[model samples]
Target: MSLTAGILAGAAGTTALNIAGYLDMTVRGRPASVLPARAAGELAERAGADLGSGETADSRREGLGALLGYATGLAVGGLYGLLAGDRRLPPPVAALGLSAMAMAASVTPLTALRLTDPRDWSASSWVSDIVPHLAYGLTAATVYDRLTRL
Candidate 1:
């Protein structure tokens, strides 16, 4: 039940994050980041899997990248569920912690793979990264709390 709740919470959070991202893009007139797809391609290559070349490869990378994001969100939520385990952190604390965790989960791998360096990000870049994550954390924590109470 906890796991189920966490996953549902994660889905809600992921949706919120995506919406936030799209909103930011609309507001700023910025193009979507291709880092996710690039990360997917890199990981696939390391694992000895060929995604092939050309448009089909690009399509595969994009799909796989999105799936990877979903997988990360769900896994993080699951871990949060297990760790939280009938204990409720304060709302602010929960949100901050979850956001930090999500950010780290998403960024650390990219950093390790040399795809991005958060340290080099500008203020706008930070804002772009953080806003959606904040949305994710707030929504996920709230949903998890609500679901666990049922």
Candidate 2:
């Protein structure tokens, strides 16, 4: 429930999410999602940091996406800890709520910026998004629950 615990749990959760996403990609032979990286690159450009040439720019963009993802998880996890107080929701329910909240946090902004349009997303796209977030939520909630108890 503490801020430190939330951040540590969030980092773990984000790692789990990445594993789940990579597993899905391996199983389905799908390419990694480019939207987050692209968004990061755009943000960097807006911030005036010319990130270098072609492949280097791509690498930096990917790193930025990952950094942002972990940051988002830490922030959201802190919110969960703050809101849960002394009593917490059942793990399963909390996980789902966390997932939904993360999705809302992400998709809403992307949609507003026209970086992504969920309306145009295919079933597979939805699956890709949901699966990783579900992993993140489950791991986050479980870790937070354990850490708070300790």
- Name the candidate that leads on TM-score: 1
Clash list (residue pairs), candidate 1 = none
For model 2, state the Cα shift of residue 14 in Å.
0.7
Query: Per-residue lDDT for 90-132 in model 2, tens only?
Result: 9899899878877777777678767999999999899999998
TM-score of each: 0.97, 0.91
Computed on alpha carbons, the lDDT of every model, listed in order, comes to 0.91, 0.84
TM-score of 1: 0.97
* Cα lDDT of model 1 by residue, 1-150, tens digit: 778888888888888999999999999999999999999999999999999899999999999999999988888788888888789889889888888888899999999999999989999999999999999999999999999988
Give the distance in Å from residue 21's predicted Cα in candidate 2 to where it truly belongs. Answer: 0.2
User: What's the distance in Å from true for residue 26, model 2?
Assistant: 0.4
Error of 2 at 99 (Å): 0.8
Error of 1 at 135 (Å): 0.1
Weakest lDDT window of 10 consecutive positions for candidate 2: 1-10
Predicted structure 2: lDDT = 0.84
